[model samples]
Target: MSNEDIYLCIIGLCIVSYIPRVAPFLLLGKRQMPHAFELWLKYVPTSVFGALIFCSIFQTDSGVDFSFSNISMLAAIPVLAVAAKTHSLPYSIIVGLAAYWGLQQVM
Candidate 1:
């Protein structure tokens, strides 16, 4: 493809990528959202985070990996426990990194 085509594709991609994100704010600007909808929005970040983390933690080059060999999955065990018990992001992060580092050293 020519440079012009590449530039146009990039611009088109930028527009498409931004529309979904911007449209909601534009449509909802300065308006009070319903209680149910507001309650539901609270879960969006958690769900999105889980979706993003699930694949990297659970999968590998060959296929799905749930074994102890996967340090990420192994590390997640203590992270989950600490996060649930403490409900603290910093503690969870520290535990996760430490767990992963320790597992990496051992394995």
Candidate 2:
């Protein structure tokens, strides 16, 4: 295919994708969701967070190397512990990032 054809196809797909995602929110403004669906939505945050934490912990550049070399992961331990114990996102993030920066400097 020509460059023009590919560009047109991508634009068409993007427009198609945007309609389904945007249309419902635009048309149905703050409508009540079913109780069951609302309850299910409550789990989404934890599930997404768990997935992110799992990916961050298990994934690496070369392979599975859960070492102090990974400053983010190292910082995440204290972050998770403090967040869990205190239930404070702002404090956890601030302390975690500071620890990460400190570790990066040392390494």
Candidate 3:
């Protein structure tokens, strides 16, 4: 496309992408949510995170594997423990990487 056409397309794309992201802030910025709903929202991120990780940790090439031989499953134990005990993402990540790496070394 020509320069003007390309610029118009870029502007249109920016507007389309920006509206959805900005709409939430504009709509909710001045509002006060109920306390219970706000508290409920706290679990959203970790729930989503756990949903994503659960499949990778438990699933194998053949099927769902819950056995100790599953490295990701094994690694997740300490990762979860560190996350729960310390409530630190960096520590959990470090423990996860260390667990996965150490497991990779041995088994």
State which candidate has the highest TM-score: 3
lDDT of 2 by residue, 1-107 (tens): 99999999999999999996996688676676678977997899899999998788667878776776776678788888889899998998888888888888998
lDDT of 3 by residue, 1-107 (tens): 99999999999999999996896688696887788977987999889988899998998899999998999999999988888899998999899999999999999
**Ranking, TM-score, top scorer first:** 3, 1, 2
Between prediction 2 and prediction 3, the one with superior lDDT is 3
Q: Which residue pairs in model 3 clash with each other?
A: none
Candidate lDDT (C-alpha), each = 0.91, 0.83, 0.91
Query: Cα lDDT of model 2 overall?
Result: 0.83
The deviation in Å at residue 60 for candidate 2 is 2.2
After superposition of all CA atoms, the RMSD between model 2 and the true structure is 5.5
Residues forming the 10-long window of minimal summed lDDT in candidate 1: 23-32
Give the per-residue lDDT of model 1 (tens digit) for 1-107: 99999999999999999997997788786777789988998999999989888987998899999887889898999999998899999999999999999998999
lDDT (C-alpha) at residue 80 in model 2: 85
Determine the backbone clash count of candidate 1: 0
> TM-scores of all models?
0.63, 0.58, 0.64
What residue pairs are clashing in model 2?
Answer: none
- On TM-score, the stronger of 1 and 2 is 1
